[model samples]
Target: MVYIAGEEMTHYATELFVDQWIKPYFDISTWETYDLSCKSRDVTDDKVLHDAVEAGARIGAIFKEPTITPSTVQVKEMGLSKAFGSPNGAMRKGWNGITISRDTIHIKGIELGYKNQVLFERHAVGGEYGAGYNEVGAGTLLTTYLPDDNSPPFVVDKRDLTDDNNVVVVYHNPYDNVKELAHIFFGRCLEHKVTPYIVTKKTVFKWQEGFWSTMKEIFEKDYKDTFLKEGLLERSGNELTHLISDAATMQLIRWTDGGFGMAAHNYDGDMLTDQIAQVHRSPGFITSNLVGKSDDGSLIKEFEASHGTVSDLWNDHLAGKETSLNPLGLVEAMIGAMQHAAMLDVEKHPDDASKLEVKMKVLNFTETLREAMHNTFRYGQGTRDMSGPSGFSTEDFIGKVAWRLNR
Candidate 1:
C-alpha cells in the first residue's frame, strides 16, 4: 500500500501522522512510504507527485489527502476587488466555489483509465425534493422549474443486445435511466456468462410500481433459457416465497457468501455495499464504480471513492485541532482502481501471472487499515468524542495502519 501526503502536510507532520496515528497498529518496516511534502516536490520539481501516482497505479490502491488549498479568509478580508484589481469581479465560481484543476492530481476515472469499468453510483434522493418536502409548499410549486414546458418527451428505447460483456443496472425510480442501463448490462452479462439480479419493492407497488415489474418481466422472458442453462434459476425451498425485494436481498447475501458474482440495483446495491464493507469492518476498504452504456451498448466505467470528503473533520484539521476522519473509502477507491489495472494486465499477458499477487496486495491493504483502526481505539488515542471506549484521533487511527503496513 502507498500513501501520498500532499504539499500541505510536512514530512515531519506526515511522519508524525503515520507514527502517532498509524504506526502502533501496523508494522510498516517492510512496506514503502514516500513523503511528497511541498519541500520535496519543489526539490524534485514536482516529479515526485507523478512518480507517486504512477506507483499507486502500479500497486492496487493509494490514499491522498486534500491538497488543493482553499482561498484564504485573508484574501476575502482584503476585498476581492483590491486583491485582483477589479471593481466588480467574481472571485470564485464553480462547484463549491472551488475550481479543481485536472493537473493538480490525476483523479481516478476522470483522467486515467475508466473505460469498460463497472462502477457503483450511490446518492440520496426524495428526502429533500419530494411532495411536501421542499421549502415551498408541495402544491404551491406546480411546475417546479422554469422551461418545464420546453422539455422534450420521455423516450424509451428497446433494442437488441449489442455488447458482449455483461452489465447490471439497478435503481429506484420507475423512470430512472438506470433501468435502461440495467437492460443493457443484463444482456451483456448474459452474453459474457455473468449473472445479474434486480431487487425492488414491486410486491407493494404493483401497477403503481410498474418500473421494476416491467424490468423483471423483460429479464425473465428475454433471458430465461440462458439463465436456466447457466444454473442461475432455481426454485426456493418453500412453496410460498417472500416478496421480490426480500428474495433479492437474500440472494445477494447468499451469492456474496458463496463467492458468486452478481450486480445489484441502486438503493439495494448501496445498502448491500455498505453491509459488505461493514462485514469486512472497513467501509474505506471498498471501491465503487459508475458505468454508462453507450449507444453501441459498450460501457464507460468511472471509479470514485465510496466515501465522501470528511468535510466536518477537515475544518478541524485546518484549525490544528484533533480529528478522527477515516480515509478508508478513499483508500478502497485506489484499491479498486489497482484491481482493475491488474485485471487488464492479466488479460494482456496471461503468461506472466500476477493476479494472485495483486489480490494479496489488496488484502494486505485492508488488513493494515483494519489493524490500525483497532490499535488506535485499543490504545485510546483517537478523537476525544470517539475516545470513550472506541474512538481515537484521526492521525492515531491512520498511524496504526501505517505501522502495520511497515511491519
Candidate 2:
C-alpha cells in the first residue's frame, strides 16, 4: 500500500489517528510512504508528487492525505516556488482512472440528512479541467480536430465574435473511455442494488449528447438485462433512465432516502457530489475512492477523505487552543485502503492459507474499529462537530474510540 502525507491540520490529525487507532493492531512497516506537503513539493520541484502517483499505480492501493493546491496568494505566503497544480489530475491520469466514487457514510443510530446511500461516479478526465481558452478582441473563433491518419481536419466549432471583450474556451470529452466508465458505473449500481442514472445536458449543449448517447448504448448492451433481473429497474419506472443535470439536482433533494446511483460528466459530477456530501450531513461523512485500470488491466484504487485540509482548525491548534476537528472521513478512508490492500492480497494469493488468514484478520480489525467509532458517536461521545458543544475534544474522541476497541 502507498501512504501519501499532506499539509495542515488534517496531516496532524492523520498522524495522531494512525498512531492511536491503527498502529496497535496493524503492522504497516512495509507500506511505501510519500511526503506531499507544500514545502516538500517546492523543495523537490513536485517530483515527489509524480513519484507518489507512480508508486500508487505500482502498489494498487493508496491512502492519501488531503494536500493543498497553492493559489497565487498561498504561493506567496508559503514563500516557495511557483504555484503547483492539484496532484489529483496527475494521479488520475497516471492510474488510467475511470471514475471517482463518492458515497454517503451511513452510521447506524445516527440520523443524518439522508436516510439511505447516495453514490456518485464522476468521469475522471477530459472536460473543463483541461480546457484551453484565450481572451481576444473581435474576431472569428474557429476550433478544429485533425485526424492523425491525415484524411482531413474537421471544424468542431465556428463563431463570430462581435464583442471586443470575449473569451473562447474549447474542450473535448474523450469517448474512448466512456465504455469503460459505463461498465464500472452500472456494475457498481448492480452490486449496491441501487437504481442507476446518467446525467447530462444534452438539450442545451449538443456536444454533451455524445456522452449521453455513449452511456445509453453501453448500458443497453451490457447492463440492462442484469439490472432488470436484479429488480433495479423497478426503482426507476421499469427501465434504465437518463436525467438532465438540472432535473438530477432537484431529484437529489426530493429523494431523501437515497437508493440510487448517478454518473455524470466530470464537471457536473464534481459539483453534484459536493451536494451529496452536504446532504449526508457533512463532507466528513463520506468516502472518496478513485477506481482505475492499470496497464495490465488490473484494478488500481486510491482512497482519501472527501473534505479539505481544514486549515482553520490547524490555525487554532497552532495557537495552543483546543480544537475539535472531526476525523471521521480520514479514519474511514484509512480503513477502506487497508481493506482494499487485504482484498488484493487475497486475490493475488488465492491458494495461500496464510494470506487468507491475514485478510480475515484485517477484516475483523476494520469491522471492530468501525463499530467502535460508530458506537462512540451513537452514545454521545464524539468531537464537538458531530456531537454537541458538550462533546469530547479531538483527542478525547479518539481516546473514546480506543477505549471501546480495548474493551
Candidate 3:
C-alpha cells in the first residue's frame, strides 16, 4: 500500500503498517511515503493534490486525510473579509466525492444482452432501499446475484427473487459527484424495478445546484412511468418532493419507518452511513461498492473497505507495541473487489470456467477471513498491548488476520 501522509499524525500510520503489518509479508524496500504538508502543497502550486487524485485513479486505491492549514482556517474565519476573493470559501475543497455513472446488469442465466436491456434492468431496480441509515433500517445484506454452472443448484438460486422486493435509498454528500452518482444509483433502481428519489436543497443553491436538478430532469424524462407507477410521484398529499437537506434528514427517519427509497447528498451520506454501519455492529461487515463510469452505462464495479486509517491505534505500533486494530475491513474490501472483478471478467468471457473458480475462491476467502477474526477474538490468541483496557496491539490484530488468511 502506497500512502500520501497529509498530516504529521498520518505519518504514524505508514510507519505502523510498513514496519509491522506489511513488511512481514512483502519486502519494505519498494514501499515509499510522500509528505503533503500545506507548505509543500503550496510550494508545488496545488499540483500535488491533483497528482494524488490522478494517482488514485490509476492505482484504484488511495487513502487521504482531510487537508487542514492555518491559512485555510484563517480564510474561513475571516469569511467576508476578502472582498475580492472568489465567491466560494478560500479553503480548497478536496475532490473526495466519487464520480459513478455507469450501470451493469447481471442476469442469473442470460447471456449476450444489449446495453439497453442491461440499463433498463438497472433502472427498474431504482430506490429499492432507503438512504444511508435508512438502508440498514430497511434490511441487511443488499446483494444481487446470479447462478453459474460450477456452483451447486442449491447455492445458485438461494437469494434470487422473482419480483423486485428490495428498495435502495442512497445518501450522497455535498462534495460527491451528484450527477454521476445519481445516474448510476437510479439506473440500479430501474434495473431492479425499485423506485428511486433524490433529496436535495437545490431550491436554495440554484447556481451550485446543477447536479441534483440534472438528476431530477433525467429521471423525469427517462423514468417517468417507473416513478409514477410505483406511486412515488404524489405521496401523502404532496407531489414527489425534493426536500432541503435538514428536512430530508428528518424525513428519512420517518420514511425508514414508512418504507420510502431516498438518495441523500454527500455529507449526509457520510454521517449516516457511519451511523448505519455502527448499528450493524460490524463496520467490517459492511460492503461498499464503487460503481464506476462506463461508456455502455453503469457498472457494478469496484468495492472497498469503508473504514478509516485507524490513526489512534497506529500510534501504539510506533512505540513498538501491539494493538487490536481490526483487519476485517481490509479483508472484506479485497474480497469484494476480487468478486466484482471476477464477475466482470466472466461477463466478458462467458466460456471461461476459471472465472467461476476464481469467484468461488474469493467468496471462500471472505468467509475464512471472517472466521479467523472471530476465532482469534473468541480464543484471545492475539497479543496484547497496554494502550487501553482492551490491550490489543495493532500488529497483534493484523497478525491475527494474516495468520487466518494464510491458513
TM-score of each model, paired residue for residue: 0.41, 0.96, 0.47
Write the residue-wise lDDT of candidate 1 on 1-407 in tens digits: 45545433222244464555345544556443454543454466556655654454344334444342224563364333222211001111100111100001112222111112222223222111122322322221122233468876543333343445433232223244535544554565555454454445656745325544555666666766776777544442211122365675555444432312233334555565565554333444455544332233322232344544445565667898876554544444444444554454455466765765665665675555545544544565543443443665656556555565566
Report the number of the highest-lDDT candidate: 2
In candidate 1, which residue ranges exceed 4 Å CA deviation? Answer: 1-287, 292-301, 352-390
lDDT of 2 by residue, 166-263 (tens): 98888877778888888888888888888999899988977888887888898889888898888889978877788999999999888888889999
* RMSD from true fold, candidate 1: 14.3
In model 2, the clashing pairs are none
Supply the TM-score for candidate 2: 0.96
lDDT of 2: 0.88
RMSD of each: 14.3, 1.5, 18.2
User: Could you give candidate 3's per-residue lDDT for residues 87-154 as a string of tens digits?
Assistant: 00121122233332212222222221221121111111112122353222223444333457655333
* Decreasing lDDT order of the candidates: 2, 3, 1
- Cα-lDDT of candidate 3: 0.44
